[model samples]
Target chain A: MTRLLTLACAVFTMTLVGCSESGSGDDTLTVGFSQVGAESGWRTAETESIRSEAEARGIELKFSDAQDKQENQIKALNTFIAQGVDAIILAPKVETGWEPVLKKAKKRGIPVILVDRGVEVEDESLYVTLIASDFIHEGEQAAKWLAEKTGGKANIAELQGTPAASAAIERKQGFEQEIAKHPGMKIIKSQTGDFTRSKGKEVMEAMLKGEGGDEINAVYAHNDDMALGAIQAIEEAGKKPGEDIIIVSIDGVRGAFEAMVAGKLNCTIECNPLLGPMAFDAVEKALAGEEQPKRIVVETTIYDQSIAADVIDSRKY
Target chain B: MPEALKKLLWPLAALGVLLLFNTAMNPAFFSITISDGRLTGSLVDVLDRATPVILLALGMTLVIATAGVDLSVGAVMAMAGSLAAMLLVDMQAHLSAVIVLTLGVCALAGLWNGVLVSIVGIQPIVATLILMVAGRGIAQLMTDGQIIPIDSSPGFAFLGGGTFLGLPFTITLAVSAVVLTIVVIRFTALGLFIESVGGNETASRYAGLSVRGVRLSVYTFTGLCAGLAGLIYASDITAADANYAGLYLELDAILAVVLGGTSLMGGRFYLAGSVVGALIIQTLNTTILMTEINGASVPVEYNLVIKALVVFVVCLLQSETVKQMIMRRRAVHD
Candidate 1:
């Protein structure tokens, strides 16, 4: 029993030692960041940007990868609050399970900044500023390109992103709003690809079979991964993809441009993911007691086959 | 009625009632069509979507028959695809078909799992869990965490995208696997031995059956199923993203297996029931997406609720007390 107690003490002491090493620093602007993990390329870039930006500004950034779980993110946030960090940044896994944590942060006077994703809190005072791309606008840009390319008439299919994500919800709404204007444009079938390439291909193949390859005038994806997957399904059906069935999607990742250069993808809307520098700028302003808006929209651009080749060299993310 | 039929009656009846209710609500629910020499619409979609789940559940049925469970099938799928992608990187176009390469890699991954469970004497859950966490990481490491695009594999494309006699090739593969599993379980003595081992390992050993061999074979078989599903998955996309392929598929496969009346504690097995369970799950998902409920949303996450409800209903039906109560109530009404 004595040995067992010593062993337990040793383990607990080791954890405390590790925590102190990670948390100790003087003249440090402690910033707690809860990430969604290395789930995608965009997320990795976001992590890198935040790490580098924090380093450059001499801020001690305590980073936590929640591994795509809401409970993990909440635990990390509470840990940060307990440590008494100056500020907190969260990329919420889901929108609803955040009100309680954000409320705790608000009670402690710890300002929260939402990056890349948004939360569904009814209280506007929970978060200081939300730095995210205009998801609906990204959808609108893709739809606008498809409309002009198809002359305001096409039988289209939609490959949506993950269901619970704010990006997917807003993007679908935005695309539907734009497509609703044109009487000739119709979405014959739509399904959630779950922001995954494999599922995108599977759903796209089903859509192709149901609508008939020729009936599908275009394909609109919530992101580049699904669009790329749809391209594969189109080619497998012994039909030309970009020429026979046009494709439009969002996310300005390099994969989209590569597809564009190959003439397999027609258009892609750029949703800038590297928001670390701008996010830090907001953090600085908020720390200085300046009132920041509840919403901050990031800039975006639409790239088609025409500009895809030229812009391929300069595409950062 | 036979004992097996008696065991399966309630779940089948429940599934029928659910289908009947759904068809009543939607006029176009039962509209299945074959147009222009191809199967079109929701039926085709359900078949295509159920392929992976059916494959995994078939393997899982055998694994559960040995009193063991594999929570790593989905991760193994990703790992197998990632390994195949890595192998194809150096191979010339004329060297091998992508389908052959994918199968080879998947087989090797299955073998790895088999060795860990049988030789290392690790708990099946822990053995596969290691692979589950590390497999995706390995896949990411293989592709340098990038999506590897493959556009020129005709054989590969056919596995996922091509149709065999007006049916998707994936469905054909799944059906073939189910049939093969049914043959193994019914025609051969392997099924009886597996049940004996799961029922009581010591008793099976005393009876002179190779219990270790049975356990090893089931794990390997599960791995092979996951591998085949991975191939179909990658072929459908024509690209491999190590991060997202087959994510959370093991959960769905387990759900399908459990829903089919296969006990998590092990001993009897069912292949055909699992196939039907996969279809029921896919149909439930489709119904949720098609139906417009006030203040409710349709997304992958929403499927979790539907899955939970289905599991609850199936479990309730499986309970002898509940079944007897329902029968008594029906008799009184009649």
Candidate 2:
């Protein structure tokens, strides 16, 4: 048994060494990517897009699934730094716990591109560039659409994302800022659904109970998951969701469009997660020392029930 | 009175002290009101959130009573909720009432845990751990890794949203479960048998008590509790995201059990104390967030750190060395 265990350990070590040797070539560009994990459809799509883009570019992508852990992502970044990768791409799980890692990467002269999510670091030079959707803009768009649909007089309940996530914080800020402009529109009750469908449903149920049936006119979810939950709560209360309570959310996922077409979802603000092509472009520019904006804001569009059917069929992710 | 009542004094005293501290700090802490005939505000929210942890702790109490632990209750909740969601996919409109669907699915998941721990003879921690990792994967797979929003389910909504006597429906369910559990343990000989088995499995078998049966029943009970929590969770959200339902709830439940003075080594149990313990934890979390003391600098994740500290302090107090030291100090002071 002792001999067998020794042999197994030896074999595993050799397999890893052999795998690394096979991929070590001069032409291959080593790109390290720290992902948030396969937590949602958006994340999976982002992963696939990154993989496909890396393959097409002939870049050796060192991918790490952080599993929604900041420490894991930090470890992965350090590992990439030690391995001396040409560039690094990170989709942070949360905003703040990233300053030290980014500073380390900057000191090492490895270009770090922020993808999908932004970090809360004071020094702008620590990161090469941020490639992400304008999260606050997405929230603003969702609120704007809801305001127009309801004629600016509506009692709204908000289902926010995970409390610490940068996306949730910015999205809430943007929505609140826009809604505050309209005196008639008020957020009657707001809660952190933690970007989970069940929490969204639970919070919405509580909101429904608190606000009374048919008292709420709209729900502005930070993401499609919460909007879907609000729809369930509304329907369970023996009311039509889109008619009785307009549902507007971010994350233009396939489900969001389907619901829009079915008239259950009122509108969705697109926050594109497919940042592979753009991220690659930023990486190439940073490596070549070309001038690039510190923050790259990806443009987004609002989708309503009218065009939802037409676009739902062709939606890639 | 009874020895059971005597056993509860410490926990009750701890609760009283904490409540006093809270009231002193915030004058409005004890103020609870009903608006539009419904309980509104932070107190109601605390009760609503405590429901899931209360159920998990109740089941854990029994598992610990058997000298074992189940770290997979949260995963079981995800799996049961996912299974129910999968079954209701096409039959969303035609499915039975929310209570039936939720309870039935949870029962099935509970049975799965019981079989693995009892029949397979796998260690309780290892068995539940497998479900913890795989159950979330299964839940994600059920929804095709997407968040499924369920609309038009009044029966489901009522499970989470409806109120009774100005209290949320979930609190009512939790209270009833506690009562039912108390009856089973106190009124029947099963509770005594379980304690005897937990105290010494070898001796329990030698005495002709069905040790395996007791073990199975404890895990099954935990599974049911987790299932009920899942239903309440799902009903509240009105949609199921297999990834996030009951996430990290096992930790909270464990913390509650520990806070109530129940030993992880397992021997006896305290169901009511555990419920209060769960409420205490929720209140602490709510208070921390409401104060808004720069969560970014001192992130909300520090709640886990605080929980670990509380557990450490309690476990230290439980240690013979600490107890002896305290007794020595007391004797000298007297």
Q: In DockQ, how does model 1 score against the reference complex? A: 0.25
True contacts kept of each: 0.31, 0.24
Can you write out model 2's per-residue Cα lDDT over B65-155, one digit (the tens) per residue?
8887887878777766666666565566345654566666666666677788878988878988887888778777777766665546667
Q: What is the lDDT for A217 in model 2?
A: 83
DockQ for each candidate? 0.25, 0.18
Please give, for residues A1-317, the per-residue lDDT of candidate 2 as tens digits: 99999999998787656545543547578899999888777788889888889999998899999977889999999888777788999998888878888888888688999987777889988888888888888888988898899999998877778877778888989998999999999876666777766556656755564423236788989988778767875775557889988899998887788889889999988866677999999998988899899889887888999999999877777
lDDT tens readout by residue for model 1, A1-317: 99999999998787656545545546678899999887667788889889999999999899999978889999999998777788898988877889888998888788999987788889988999889888889888888889999999998888888876778988999999999999989877677888887767766765565323347779999988888878876775567789999999988788899989999999988867778898889888998999888889888878899988998897655
Q: Give the TM-score of candidate 2.
A: 0.69
The C-alpha TM-scores of every prediction are: 0.76, 0.69
Model 2 / residue A129 / CA error / Å = 1.0
- The A-chain TM-scores of all the candidates are 0.84, 0.83
